[model samples]
Target: MATPRPARAARVLLPALVAAALLGGCSTTVTGTAAPDPAPRPTEGVGADPVAWGDQVCGALLSYYQPLSARPDYAGADLPGIKDRLSGYLGNVRTGIDTGKQQLADAGASPVSGGDQFRTSIEDLLNRTGTTIDEARADVDQADPNDVPGFQERLQAAEEKLRTIGAAEGLDQLGATPRLDKAIAEAPRCGELDALTAPS
Candidate 1:
């Protein structure tokens, strides 16, 4: 017996896919001094338990991403400052992702129903996200005003890849869970990203 091609691809490309999704750019102008926190919602539904668990994971992600989204334009800023800020932002994101994965594991949530794919996906995503963050920092260090267009292009590409993967993986369908759906919808920073990448 042989594994189906889609299964093989999912196994082989899971890391890359999750990484692309995590790195996908969701640009929004953050306002106010503080970002909104994830609110508590009732856990009720077919997958209510997992949905609740996933909310925590998503909350962790939003905390980091929301702040990063709020940061002023890094283009043409002091190179050293931009690099340092981006480095810090990436560090926070790394931490959040790790914590989110741990939370998911603790709750025994799986990307696929009754499968261990979520854990593997999170680990792979963390590793790749770290690398991407480093690369982004490097780009910042080397960036000039002329680099804006190229940088935007890269961001768009990453975002598109994430959107495609999310759709293929049925992440969009997860939004059917009321609580998780509301959390994502109300999230200040990740709202657009979640909408664009995850299924509605």
Candidate 2:
């Protein structure tokens, strides 16, 4: 089946949505001047070494979306080519999530309170998102030309669910820590994903 063309919004927003989930709801605000070579600066948040840890995790996720943001057209001129590209895109997203999970574990960054719960929640969320992306890719691959609308509906629904989860977890509130927030804002690649996806 031929894959349906995505709307302008979807084309722009999809990468940002995935990037946000991978960042554990980190803010997309870019502030200050990014260092020519910004290393993760140490930050003191609710947990031990939360800043450094968050930086590492968020950085990894953002890096994945950075290249996508640079692409003028995620969907190429050919429909079949677009489907193939999307398959590769989903695979990359899944790999990034897996790598981010490993980085989080290795960094041992946990909140001061409910550390285990927090870590579990994050891991579960990442895993679920990866699974959903896999499903979306399958749907894309198998979609008939007439099935494009349905596929789009399902994809949007999945994205909405992810947004709800992030909000419920107060990911945007991570900016409460001024220093950490600043660090995140100043990170060179922090807002790149969102910038590309945001509506003009």
Candidate 3:
């Protein structure tokens, strides 16, 4: 019985030794098919979370548009963008008023008609905007007493459009950055709102 046990042990040892030797020999035997290492974790698009991008986009638009509406005569080719350009945007508003004035000049003293009425209204708005801004200098003057409702109505419509913009095209079509940037640059809210307010 002891001899049989030894023989059995030897048989097990012999196979294991042979297997070890085979392992050392490069390509001495073929391995059965293996499952293969899990595909390397994907590296593409690792840091592009849409929600995070959306928030960044939202914040940037808010910052950009905050002061734009105040200045309506802001018609320039583009912005300097070297410095903060807070004044540059104000310049745009100035340009918008200037452009309106230039058009009025070109019209050569024609009494205001259809579109002209809207233009005149805008000129008046430019003046009112200055007064409105002065009123906001202190909380006691939270809003301009007279222009408050008008100003609020204008900005409110704009804000409503801006608020819905992210949801409308979806973060997908415009994407986070460009979409947000587009809303700021084009001021779509102001576009439609202004058009509606303009002559029929």
Candidate 4:
């Protein structure tokens, strides 16, 4: 069987890959199908239960990620078609990032100690990813579709920027705090994240 185009075209487009980092998974494999939406988790403020708090955090990130990974495939398409599809994919990514940020804000301050730091780290990662994707989208918009070499070069540059998505510090610290570690491990929604990132 052939490799999925989204994985083949750009691994950065997969939210499961990013979620692996967020949920403390060491690695991930891209699947062509999008993971099912996690059950409706509370959108309100953090609760005393660390598991509940973890659910809120995981929910916010997964909400947008579900749609973000359903990227358009450009395999075998002409240059013009490829350009359009690629641009659309990036635009969707930007929209997903915006939605995730707002959702995180709405989820309010974390109840667990050091949770705020963890949340901030995620926000920083999203900010950096958003900036890089936005820049790449802009470049794609200006690229001449007829110029195959130039378009390919632009895609390569975008891929390079995206390869650095999960390098944020707080992610590595997910296991550092026992409270958070338990929450992330036991949260219902977080379990979904684990399933999505697990090799399939």
The best candidate by TM-score is: 4
Query: Candidate 4 on 99-150: residue-level lDDT in tens?
Result: 8788678666666555676777767866887897788777667767678677
Query: How many clashing pairs in candidate 3?
Result: 8
- Better-scoring candidate (lDDT), 2 or 3: 2
Tell me the TM-score of model 3: 0.23
TM-scores for all candidates: the values are 0.40, 0.50, 0.23, 0.70
- Measured on C-alpha atoms, candidate 2 has an lDDT of 0.45
Output the worst ten-in-a-row residue range by lDDT, candidate 2.
1-10
In what order do the candidates fall by TM-score, top score first? 4, 2, 1, 3
TM-score of 2: 0.50
Model 2's C-alpha root-mean-square deviation from the true structure amounts to 11.1
Tens digits of lDDT, candidate 3, 46-158? 11322232232223222222334442232341222211132344344344434534433333211211222222443354444433323322212232324544434433332
Error of 2 at 53 (Å): 2.3
The models' CA-based lDDT, in order, is: 0.39, 0.45, 0.28, 0.58
Q: Which stretches in model 2 have alpha-carbon errors above 4 Å?
A: 1-12, 15-51, 67-76, 111-121, 144-200
Instruction: Give the candidate number with the greatest lDDT.
Output: 4
State in Å the error of residue 105, model 4.
Answer: 0.8
Model 1, 73-157: lDDT tens digits are 4455453444455546545555655665565455443322312333344445545554554554454445443565565454444
Predicted structure 4: lDDT: 0.58
Models, CA RMSD each: 13.6, 11.1, 33.9, 10.9
